[model samples]
Target: LIITIFYSTDNPLNKSAITVPQRAVSTFDQQDLSINMHILKWKVTLEMIKDKPLFGSGIGTFKINYLDYQADFLQKNPGYIKYSGKAAEAHNEYLQMLAELGIPGFLVFLSIIFVFYSLALKYLKNKHNNQNRLIVFGLLMGITCFLIHCLFTFPFHVPVLGSTFFIFLGLSVVYIGGFGLSKVDTKKNIRIKLNLNYLIKKIIIILMFIVGIFLIYTLVFKPYFAEIHYFKGIKYYEKGNYNDALKDFKHAVWLAPYNGRILHALGSTYYHLDIQDEAQETLQRTKYYFNDRNIFRNLGLSYKQSGNYQEAEKEFKQAIYLDPNFTKAYIDLAYLYATQEDYDKAIIEWNKILEIEPNFSEKYNVLYFIGLTYQKKQMPDKALEYFLEALQLTPEGSPIIEEIEKEIYNIYKDRLNK
Candidate 1:
């Protein structure tokens, strides 16, 4: 079916108008097959975990058991395992709950879905009102889609997806419950009248207002606390207290896992402590969490410091890929090449830097390195040219000027003696 879809020919739907071509039809068929396979895997997964429908194995344990489960399944049913190499998940909502949380969790999960569906059905039957029905229908469809998608993807295990799913679930429950209650209340003699005691009414209103404000503050302004911790981490970083910096940054990232800067800071702190592996892992995680070019640069630096030159080069390139005009990446790449004695590659990187920022303040450093490279390559005259350029850029009595002058003197003296 997949092959037929991908290789199918297009035919005109009408004599006057264009239709989906055979190529498109084929592609669609292939895609349809892939989706079907995904759905089938999810179904099999659900059936496998049907017996363990309550209180799942435990939170975050599915992946560990997934391989073993797949191996056992493959051993018993070779036909099913032939299509896909391995099954990593049960792929069904109830199965995921059983594998991770255990039977109880699965039951609760199913109960939540059952209640939602029931409420949705009840709302549709009574609320013949179009607007309310539309709202309920939309909510029901959204929740249904969430469950269906969860079968193929571990959406419930992913932090963002899980949180979003639960939030939507809560919204669905509130709408369904509120709508049902409002309808029931309308038929009852429940008179919601204002109290004659003004003080009591004022107190109730104040309490409600306070509660509303607290909710807003907690959800909206609570992030500032994480930001405070981040800044404290920065202070610790500046003081070279890596352990404390790491702790604070970890807290900040824990509080705001999406913060790229915090992750980068944590990675850097780990790098300085000479924990190269940790630094690399943290920085990689940072990249996954955020797409900031600075993190790539920091990652490159960490790799360079750890003597992983190839990986460092890759990360520097990635940084440049993310931000072409990121001057620091160019400089770092040049320095990295220079450290490897690949003067030609180093020059190429430096030239790139010059192209991006013609009057880049670091030109002297590049010139000085170029001179050193030429000297290493046994081109004294060419090396002298770059040294002169570098010296011209340096201030009088600058250490760079002093160093270049000494080199020039030595070169000249050696040439004359020879």
Candidate 2:
């Protein structure tokens, strides 16, 4: 199925597309960034490990604490922001266990697998019955496959699959014990009557099971459902369906009220819907939970949209202070300055962006904007210099090349007329 999909007529992996180096590079970069996200997630898991090295961050705490770790990672690697939206599970299960459950829990998990293998081997050695031996071998192989899968994927994290595994494990242990109906000694298997003590113990067991189920439902099921809705909201937001996205995000926030990322998403959707006041409030709430530069950038955007230039500038500055490599904040600050006709300050901020991100993806755009800023300041010479540089940097056949050429031509025309 994967092969067929990749080779399908409409797929990017079609032979014709793969032959184009530029297209291949772009495609490869996309995949590369996705793989890098796992590594980035691993780094965050390590942070979780550091935070709770004794027992771990706690079961299911990965999703809860992930945003805080991701925020720290993004500050140092701002380029990662492109792939970061929702928090992620630690793709590596062993690392995840170590981070969440700590060393003792991790060792206990390992011991279970080790015991399973040991029992499988013991059963396999008793080849008096080849059928039972083959069954044991198959069981061993299944366990091996499961363990290997768990290394790369969170198979043990899925409630249904994980429960199935434990069930199989119990069956494997029983088979290894060679338990049989024929060997049941009914006289020795005495059944206890339901006395008061027995009834009390049964009730306690039932209560414990109920409490366990409730905890799992609240901690795991609720958050999982919330994340599903959050992703749906992101899809809606991408499709420009702000109202539906807002509804979905709000539902997610309601389900997982402690989820900082969902709150951030809700706040961003509010900004997109032009509810600047609500956006600011929600984003501020997000900031109270996580100190992420993107949160500040979005807050600044909310302030800017509401025409509160001073507050917007302060937020943008705070964002830059948090992450020096946050080029978007610098661009926002420069744009804000230019909006207020603070041309000289705008020029300085634009230059600072270059200093911080010399090879920024939008370097040409920055240069062109700096040129415009210079032109606004009546420094035609500096304006032409920057404009020409921008023109050279623009892709040969890009529409932006024509725009830069026009800007250069206008500068020359104005000088000639003067």
Candidate 3:
């Protein structure tokens, strides 16, 4: 059971890996992605559980199959995709257990918890006559608190936190003498003895130790190492070192094959290097692990760069279909249209930004870009209208102020020349 769980949650995709829609009201200020959200987006998780209510989608398969379930849910309720974020773990641990292990497995899990508490109560009663009662009670309460926390978070999925849980459990087991106070434990200073009298017991202990080492190495160290490589790749990618980024991303993917975020990054880097075939192949592979608009947007960019305008248009539209309020996708789609010299369609797409009303900072860009688009179509009056509107919102002394004024001048100058 420990081995199975270790294999299951080895790595969780970063929450921001999913390109969720943001309200136009959110500040464009830089903020960390570690969202302190308590609400569990359990609809897709429930769907997965319903699909495999018996033994589950299989141990360690939730991350693998999560995207498919999300895709189906979004297809049926397209409007909900904007509200959805990528949940690498069902925030509710028990529901995740049910999703991964099914009803029977969930019940068995419940039974174990029930037994732990039942024994804890009994142990507490016996400990009342002992000096270590306070310590035992504290440990029990800590365990209880951790369990309640698990109902809303994935702390136990983290190695150090998870280890602390078992450490508490282990201390309790030692304090309770497995079930109750032992004869020796009745003494003031109770101590646990390691009695390996039987050959079988010795063999079992040895095997357990070996398994523990293997599990720690596989579950704890490997994922941590994978995260190191992934973040290093991100840093390199941001620094415009595509080769170094690709090298590290490949290392990350190799370390944790199931992590959708790592795969997505790798595909994106390929897209950046103008390796269209590799980019498409990698992003196509990424589709299997993550269901989000970002991958589609990236794919659209790859296709556009490769001169596949039709395919590029489809991918961008698909991204918009998945997340209507995703300003980046809307922008990308508008650019795609503009590239095809379909100014009307490009204007239509850019006009959708007005409907979205992205933040003040973003709105200015949208208006200015639309003005540019109109200018490209030789509609000076319409272009000037949008340009003036953009200028009104521009910051004092912003460099873009000059740019906008120049565009306005260009309109007047072009008309004079005519």
Please state every model's RMSD to the true fold in angstroms.
Answer: 14.3, 7.3, 10.5
Ranking by lDDT: 2, 3, 1
On the 0 to 100 scale, the lDDT of residue 385 in model 1 is 94
- Where does the lowest 10-residue lDDT sum fall in candidate 1? 9-18
How many backbone clashes does every candidate have? 20, 2, 0
* Residue pairs that clash (backbone atoms under 3 angstroms), model 3: none
Q: Write the per-residue lDDT of candidate 2 for residues 248-321, one digit (tens) a residue.
A: 99999999987888999999999988999899989888865555678889999999989999999999987776
lDDT of 1 by residue, 1-418 (tens): 5544433434343342423464345444634655555554554455446534555556655543444444444455554432442344555555666667666666776887787788788878984679878988987888788887775566776679889988988887788777664545656768888756989889989999999998877666666877999999999999999899989998887777776668889888988998889899989987654556677788899899989999999988876654556788998998999899998898788778777777878788778878888887788998899899888988666778888998799789989999
Q: Which 10 residues in a row give candidate 2 its minimum summed lDDT?
A: 18-27
User: Which is the winner by TM-score between candidate 1 and candidate 2?
Assistant: 2
| Candidate 3 structure quality by residue, lDDT tens digits, 24-92 | 123232241332221325778889888989999776667666656766777787656545555668778
Query: After aligning candidate 3 to the native by TM-score, how far in Å is the CA of 308 from where it should be?
Result: 1.9
> Which stretches of model 3 miss by more than 4 angstroms?
1-37, 58-84, 123-136, 177-229, 251-259, 290-292, 321-324, 375-380, 396-403, 410-418
- In candidate 2, the residue pairs with backbone N, CA or C atoms under 3 Å apart (3 or more residues apart, or in different chains) clash, namely 55-101, 55-102
Give the C-alpha miss distance for residue 338 in model 3, angstroms. Answer: 1.9
What is residue 284's positional error in candidate 1, in angstroms?
0.4
